[model samples]
Target chain A: MKSNDISLPTVPFRTRGGVRVPHRKTTSTCESIVMTVPSQVSIPMQQHIGAPCKPTVKVGDIVCVGQVIGDSDQFVSAPIHATVSGKVLKIADIPMTNGAKCQAVVIASDGLQTPYSELKPPKTDTLDEFLSAVRASGLVGLGGAGFPTHVKLRVPKDKNVDTLVVNGAECEPYITTDHREFLENSENILYAIVKVKEMLNLKRVVIGIEKNKPDAIELMRNLIKKEGKSDYIAVLALKASYPQGGEKVLIEACTGRVVEMGKLPADAGCIVMNVTSLGKLAEYLKTGMPLVTKRLTIAGSAIKEPKNVIVPIGTMIKDVIEFCGGYSEEPKKILMGGPMMGIALTTDELFILKQNNAILAFNEKDARLMETTDCIRCGRCVASCPMGLMPPLISRAVKLNEIEELKSLGAMNCMECGCCSFSCPAGKYIVQTMRTAKAMIRSAK
Target chain B: MVGKLYASSSPHLRQGDTTRKIMLDVIIALLPACIASVVIFGYMSAVLIAVSVVSCVICEYICRRIMKRNNTIGDLSAVVTGILLALNYPVSLSPLIAIGGSVVAIVIVKQMFGGIGQNFVNPALTARIVLLTSFSSKMSNWTEPFAYLNKNAADAVSTATPLADGEHLTSYFDLFFGIHGGCLGETCVLAILLGGIYLVARRVITPLIPLTYMGTVAILSLCFGLDPIYQLLSGGLMLGAVFMATDYTTTPLSNLGRFVFAVGCGLLTMLIRQFGSLPEGVSFSIVIMNILVPYIEKFTRLKPKGFIKPKKESASK
Candidate 1:
């Protein structure tokens, strides 16, 4: 039995522990503006988690929009697509914010977002055909963790999935991309849910939306009922909490089935899909276009004209920031996602990937490093940890370079939610230490 | 942007909190008690508190400089310790005793054990016990309330405390209003309750330890065929439960472990007051429980929610 001591009073179902993050969903009502295509895009070969795609196009190669520019033979990887009709400027190694030098195809746009000639909706009379169609779509989990979408959807032969949990809990502070998706693309989202439910032979579907977005929840509920899928699909209003949309936390809240350690959602008899990922799938089925344009919330304290904007994949962050009225102040930190789980980029020159849902530029006041103090053992971190990880213990293990202690403390289970660090009165960088301990554990192994 | 952009791991945003901020909250919470002590016990108690705080801060500053540690007087933990140490002393004691306890607390107990969050026991409580041992006569010279109200300037009438060896217990009204003889801050139950509420409101301390500490004591006193309310409002139980036992560095971090630590404190305190030679055992029980915190946390470690039963490698950890 779990205690929901930290849950809000209005919450119907609750998970164990999560921090109360401010919902800075400022751009939820704004129309997602279609930005002007940049002169060029630097599409990296490795957009999502898996094997890095080998570049299929070289410098001076003419490529049309939606054409496969990079692909991997590995089953786990997704193909990279050209977002603009252009000539490839260069295919070379480039350093990324994630600290990896990967092959990138720099395309010089010809000012035309022309679709590929072979673009047509593929046949999907069966599950395998549907999965194959999805595999070629260059889609991944767009909810921050860029796990391949098709791989997540491919329920194994031995297991049977009963529920499809759509993650609509955009619980992060500044990111409202999913909220806008439910508002702007309701019809397609329903289509995807019903289609996936039928294809997977799932009994029910639960779309978990945070109560912060009452408009989206009401809109989704109205759509699900108007389509007469209420019996099969339920719109759950979740309490607004940080990491409420976390895979395991959402699964448990929606389906009451825990996604235990070392197990996928498939193991727990559910297929969890991000709301945008589902919308993208339905869009691909309609227009036969692969994932090229991504709509994301461009927001933060440093952003001048913060709003949701749709830009082609691989558009340089610098161009997008410039498109969004540039910085209000000298940017001290630029992130590729929300503040909690976002990747901090040293430069604004990095290309936006398929999974990127937010581009936040923070000034020195918000991005400055905290001065660390000794652990007071206030237990705020312990109580705030969504995974029940003892960050202080992990931090202690890291300081002592104790590999075995790190393993026993389950430092690997830390999802880097930043809940502990956010709540720390001492401002101890416990999550950073856990990341260090994870690296140490891996090396020791 | 001209300046080089800073980059680090995820969760770039942090809440507005500093060690100084938290310590300041604690100091704010203790203000009621500090003022109440001065009001009830008179100008001497205020002087004692001032002496302890000043000396504790100076001792910490000098010791850190001598040991070449980073200057940590800015954290205000020494200030908190000084206040707590003075609050535990009888108002009639000399100001020199406060200075000596400051040395014992800041120099010996706190800094010697690596300062601040590194100490294994509550520094103020340890200093109190050492003072009680070294200056037994000075420590026990409890001054009655309204001692300064006597128009004639004379030495204070040293009286028996409520917890002193006697069949006559002070009235419940006197105990609650702090009209009886006891430590400066420990007598005023109302003021201490207000301070506890403030700490809880500020989120500087959780209610788990304090609730369990007093609750267990009340229940156990009832079991011992004694008046639970009389047992509660009298002595340093309320003060100890609220502030000393809930010290962040010395107690267990897990919720369940805190429950055990508080229950242990309640039980030991009751047993000592009933059977042992000491009249009060709050400090002793806390120090004993503080020593067992590492062991308590080991057994009562919060099992990660991912944990599954039927462990294959049971003996390894």
Candidate 2:
């Protein structure tokens, strides 16, 4: 499917073994509209996958937009920025969807999203300076993993990091935040690719987008050509498959490099970054604004009017849903991301975190559990797994309580992409079995 | 915040395929043969199928009730077994004797172990073997085709099957068209191939097992200095290789394991047919291969992709 419509060469790259999922990219063409500022936002201190930050502002302290209200001394942590310019309402422990409580800075908004002016774009003349700028900007992977981008962007001196892969392969169905980013913020994406490529001293930058969205792929290829860095930056059209955007899977699809088990992507001589995270980094460099707002795709069966909303971080999910014409019906289930790999929310009372890219709500019919039956030994799960791990055999190992067999079957290698369970004819929850198997192996150790 | 929202792990979405749906797909795939059986072997073949199917379903329900387990008849696996068992029977078999085969298939071979996917060996194939030993004369009493075409065709002649010898074997065209003395469904090569294609198209069964099994049998027939076309078009091999040998419960789960199992089945079937005293070997060969599924799977477990290299391999790279 080469596009000779323009002078640019369209890149078609794909890897094997991921299940095909529907792409509900209706919001891909919808330009993001800024949401009305909520009266309050409770910014959680532990948005990233690292040490939790401590709240610096107590109750009744005055705070504004882009103010660092929470900071941690740990190297892996990013500071939590105030998304709204308002008064510090309270510093309280908020319950999270994971059943743990986290410290949050609760701020009551003044209805105006005033800028936090104390910050300025730091120096990026060297590798150390660039990473420090990333950390200062409160940047983390806006993808669902919520990994701190500064740490991911940091490469060791001896690792020989060469290529930089930008993750535009939004493989999850019904989540089009990354797709919208490519369409709306193409210039910012190109700007970050050139800057990161120069700063990291990388050989080339390959932006991987799923082939389902030809518009985004074409735009990226043309944008790179227009920037006059066609040799340094290229675009890759990836096959549309569930979990194709996963770090290890994308790495294999891009360069045919295998990231070793229990090792970092840096070990494979690659650095992967999220598509939206790149745009935000470029925005931060120009405007001196930390990451306070997020682009979220709000759609599902239960949602009334779906849209691509640029809601501020820490806005309550209920308020966001209400802005999109509220629930079409009483929602039975609300997911924090796409239906495949999203975390189910106990309540809509939780505020949006930095890593959440979509909020999917489902009605009773769409959310009900399936009636399970015996596995017919169909081998569909084995064929569907991108990792090529045998799930049913691992399930049997878990049943027999064979810990060594579980370990040998590589139970720890499962990314829980939900491919096996999705393809199972018997409606068996194979991923749950893998999770339980992993837990059993861990406890036995 | 409005209601008691249910929360679980990731993957709230499902592909919505169920056990009943898969069994229904199998029944649909086997429809072409079911119709062909009644047409070729006359109305008695339909009677045999009716008795076998009713007997098996009732036996499954009663067995599950007696064992204090949930009934599995809803999945239609019992119906599938019943039809397969009926297709393996000759039209001359007594109705009471047909019920015995159904009992042996549903109760003894299937529900005794566990229902549906829990059976270790193929229930219908095993039951056909059991009946072959218990009442050999009735089980092998092959009936002539097209008895219903004549108004005064008295109790259609019982004759020697094509498997017997060169004397009874029909022409190649008649054998392929199933106009000869044989069991209800196994005589019609065209009907069975249509059903096999349907199953493969529906993604219910892969073409690997059928291709490997039939390909092995064809090559081995040539090696035995026999007419390969006659060997393939003869009794039961097409039906057994397509529907019976590919039973999910009795077969291996991995692709590699299935390949080895199908090849092994072809080897055993050819050996038994060429060397042994029995005229037919498909049922016995499948049962033998079914018993070896676990061992085949053990040797062919899938290796994880992009696995870590050992220290020695890392140094070599």
Tens digits of lDDT, candidate 1, A91-208: 8887787788878999999997888999998788999999999999888999988899888888788876788889999888989899999999999999989989888888888889
Could you say which candidate leads in lDDT?
A: 1
**Residue by residue across A76-149, what tens digits does model 2's lDDT show?**
89998999998999988888868799989999999988887787777888888888889988999887788888
Model 1, residue B113: C-alpha shift (Å): 1.1
Question: What clash count goes with each model?
Answer: 0, 0
Position B196, candidate 2: lDDT: 90
Question: What tens digits encode model 2's per-residue C-alpha lDDT throughout B1-317?
Answer: 56988797767888777888888988887787878888998888889898999999999999999999987899999899989999999898998988999999999998888777788999999999999999999899877788767777677577777878655458998888888888898988898999899889888899999989999999999999877788788978999999999998899888899999999999998998899899779999999999999999889878776565333423667
Q: Which stretches of candidate 2 lie over 4 Å from their true place?
A: A1-14, B151-153, B308-317
Q: Give DockQ per model, in order.
A: 0.66, 0.66
Q: Is the docking of candidate 1 incorrect, acceptable, medium or high quality?
A: medium
lDDT of 2 at A343: 88
Q: Lowest-lDDT window of 10 residues in candidate 2 chain A?
A: A1-10
- Write down the lDDT of every candidate, Cα atoms only: 0.87, 0.86
| Candidate 1 ranges with C-alpha deviation above 4 Å | A1-12, B309-317
